[model samples]
Target: MRYHIGDLNPEELLDLYRAMLKPRMIEEKMLVLLRQGKISKWFSGIGQEAISVGVTQALREEEYILPMHRNLGVFTTRNVPLNRLFSQWQGKKSGFTQGRDRSFHFGTQEHRIVGMISHLGPQLGVADGIALADLLRRKRRVTAVFTGEGATSEGDFHEALNVASVWNLPVLFCIENNGYGLSTPTKEQYNCKDLVDRAKGYGMESRIIDGNNILEVYTKVNELCNAMRKRPRPILLEFKTFRMRGHEEASGTKYVPEKLMKKWAKKDPIANYEEFLLEKGILTEAIIDGYKNEISTEINSNLKLAFDEPAIDSNETKELNEVYQKFDYEYFEKSEDVENIRLVDAVSQGLEQSMERYNELIIMGQDIADYGGVFKITEGFTAKFGRSRVRNTPICESAIVSAAMGLSINGMKAVVEMQFADFVSSGFNPIVNYLAKVHYRWGQNADVVIRMPCGAGVGAGPFHSQTNEAWFTKTPGLKVVYPAFPDDAKGLLTTAINEPNPVLVFEHKGLYRSVYGDVPKNYYTIPFGEANLLRSGESLSIVTYGAAVHWALEILDKHPEIDADVLDLRTLQPLDVESVFRTVKKTGKLIIVQEDTLFGGIASDISAMVMENCFEFLDAPVQRVASLETPVPFAKNLEAKYLPKQRFEAALLELYAY
Candidate 1:
């Protein structure tokens, strides 16, 4: 089948020509600026303009597109303000990222442009998320995601494809096969005959197109996307093209063969399209020069405005406060109307109530839908809310996290459950880098709640029993909560779900069913930055959370004489420094406990903060009791040795004695 300029009216042809030409002109101006040292960097998409601009033009206004650094054509074609793009390159405050980052390292929700991260593959999964939201809303919008030939080697690439295929998502995977992953050639990147053939391995339909041919790229992409909207399935379209310049301005194209560069230069998309338009009597030499002159005029005008823009103000940013959205909230404590339930049941009840309250709530995890999750936390979720609400994703942590980000972008609350906290390592990049920082980089608050079933006690071995909450706690733009009791669990979980930030809820696996407490029978939320003083005394301040909270209490139960203020830190990131300091000042002594290894645990941070703030009131030096620096062992005795229980007991007794 063939389609050409004949298939389009004169107006559509002119728009397409303008669309393809604008990015080239803008980038040419940027290159001159780059040489003048006015801009620090530029990733030239000189030869690959058609793939980005043509595909973007084919999509509807509401459809979301995830473009990469080199796909500036996508932004230009979407009519993103030229002043802003130039300002972004100049690191000006008016840029999309507010100078927090430069280049296309930002996304503009208004433009439906979710830009890619430097890692280059997580956006693929995020695309799956946007497509999922469109599917759920029953919207006829196809999400188009751009990727290079190199990113096809990433696990996130396969994960995104398989997930979109499995869910039959309306995602158009536009793979610009520009022949290199930075400097590595396509022959060295993958073993497949073509990137499109690999798409078939995931049971997805695919086609290869002449990316330089603007006519083909527009006609084919429009046709495929229209078909995708009706059928609502993922399609992979590999656009064969070349990188006519260096990977970036800094990297010279010395590595690229001169012969190949010359070959592609003759196939330059703009020049060829202009000639084609002229032959079809749709463009004259005079009109072509007029387009170039008009483009250059717009570029110079925007540059003048953007160059005058001020840089990002450091004082006004208030870096930490900008990480999260600020709103007044109440901490949910145990109400007189309560029922005793295990910790896991408290989580279940909280999640159920939240789902009931927010019809837009969606829960996803591996084996969470039908199998009820590895720990049976979501046992009957699928039966109640059906598959759309309670989704079972593939074991693609990165993809799921990015997908959750995508869902949140569309104004839906998403909860992702990791079977075990240790599994987060696989998804850490998206969780820490993308999901955690999205709000800070741009103003898009990721309404995501990741439930991490963590801690060591069930002898699940290192793979499943890691207390890794500290990994995310220290990361800015992420809220980390570790609830000790059922009341706190249910309440805090409620808040985490309802909040408009990326939050990590660490549910200690050991406390899942072992501990039970009274929780409100109805829906409620607990505000962050509030600590629970489980037990009070003047002798010492026992600072701890999660399973370690139980360990502290048990030690005190054994020694009734050990008078201490046991503080359960419900939320770690928005830490309750006031309660910690107050407790420390009253007792003039402090002992922090955590199940994680001693060196880099959140307990260490608490101990340091106490010393920094309450040092003058301290009766003695601060004490920290944590697990040995080793993985959680499978053996009963080995696991016991690896826990901080014994150390916590000794620390508690000694601190009280001090």
Candidate 2:
């Protein structure tokens, strides 16, 4: 089924020709900007413009788009100001990322275009999640995800495609087969002749299109998008194209053979489409010239607007003051009348209550629905609300996190769980780069809660056992909560679920089944960044959280004469410096404790914060008590020795003596 330019109206043909010319001109200008020392670098989508421009044009304004770095054509066609692109290259305030993000890293919610991630293949999962959100809301919108052929090798690509196919999501996986991924040719990377064949492995319908033919690309994409909007099924479209320039501005074509480069360049998409338009009489030479002139004028006008646009002042305070900007005091107030309940039951009750309260809340994760999650936190969720609200995902951590981010962006509250916190590295990119930073980058908020089982007191060793709260403690836009008791866990988890940002709720392995104080049977939330002072004393401040919080309390009890002020950091990212300072002022000594390794752990951060913020009040050098720097040993004897039990107790005793 060969679609030709002759089948389209003169206006449509001219528009395609104009679209081809504009992106090329923009790419050429970007190179000039790079050479002139105005911009640091640039990535050219020169030969791949036809497919990007055409596919984006076929989709409606409300539909979502997630493009990789070499997608200037899609952004330009979607009405992203070219000047902002250039300014981003120039590291100016008027740039899309406000001088904070690198070139081609711009995204706008107003344009229905999600931010571009430089990392390959991560966006596939993000797009899948977006499609799922559209499916849940019954909205007639498709999510288009674009990436190079090389991205196909990433596990996230397979994960996203499989999930999207299984769920029948309205997502278009557009693979721009530019022949080469940087210096590596597709033949060298994969054995298949057609990239579309990989889609069959995931049980998805796919097509191979001549990406150089703008009319063919646009028509086929339009048909697929329309079909998806009707039934919400995933489709894979492999667009065959070429890269006219090197991988990036800094890359030299020394590795790429000149003969192959010339061969691909001879089949230039822009030139071929221009000839097709002229040969078919769909657009006259004069009409083509006029269209080019008109598009050029528009591009120039947008460039001027981008230049004249006010640069975002980096010196100004960030707008996210709820919890990320400063410590939230209201949620931290101590509850004198705390109820008694099992920690795991408290979590399950909180989730069940919240879902009942908010109709928009959706829960998803591996073994979450019928399996009730690994710890039975989501037990009976599917029975109560049905599968649509409580979904069980494939064992793809990247897809789970990305989908949560996408759903949150489109105005749905998502509570995504990880089977274990140790496996979070699989979805770390979306959690850190996309979900955590999207609100600050795109000037919008995403209300999503990611719950994971963390900490190592149980016998789960190595891969299954890890305290990873410190891994994300310094991430600027995310809220990291680690609750020690049943009441604190329930309250903080509820608060994180309701907060208008991506939040990581780390449930300690030791605390999940531990017997703890009762939780109130009512709707309540504990705010982030406020510490709970479990015990008050004048000798030293024992700062801790999660499982270690319980350990610290126990140690303080064993030695009542120690007189230590026990501070539980409910949230890690938004550290309560004021409270720590006040406690240190009263005690004049500090002891930081955690279940993780002492080196480069949460204890280090607490120690540094005390030294920097409360140095004047310190009477002795701040001490840190943490687990030994080794994988949690499998043997019970070694495990006990590897743990931070003695270190925490010794640190408290030493601080009291000081």
Candidates in order, TM-scores: namely: 0.98, 0.93
What would the per-residue lDDT of candidate 2 be over residues 601-622, giving only the tens digit for each residue?
Answer: 8788778878998888889999
lDDT for residue 305 in candidate 2, whole number 0-100 = 71
Clashes of 2: 6
Top TM-score hit: 1
Q: How many clashing residue pairs appear in each of the predictions shown?
A: 0, 6
**Model 1: per-residue Cα lDDT at residue 119:** 90
Candidate 2 has an lDDT of: 0.81
**Candidate 2 ranges with C-alpha deviation above 4 Å:** 1-7, 304-313, 316-339
lDDT of each candidate versus the true structure: 0.89, 0.81
Give the Å error, residue 295, model 1. 1.5
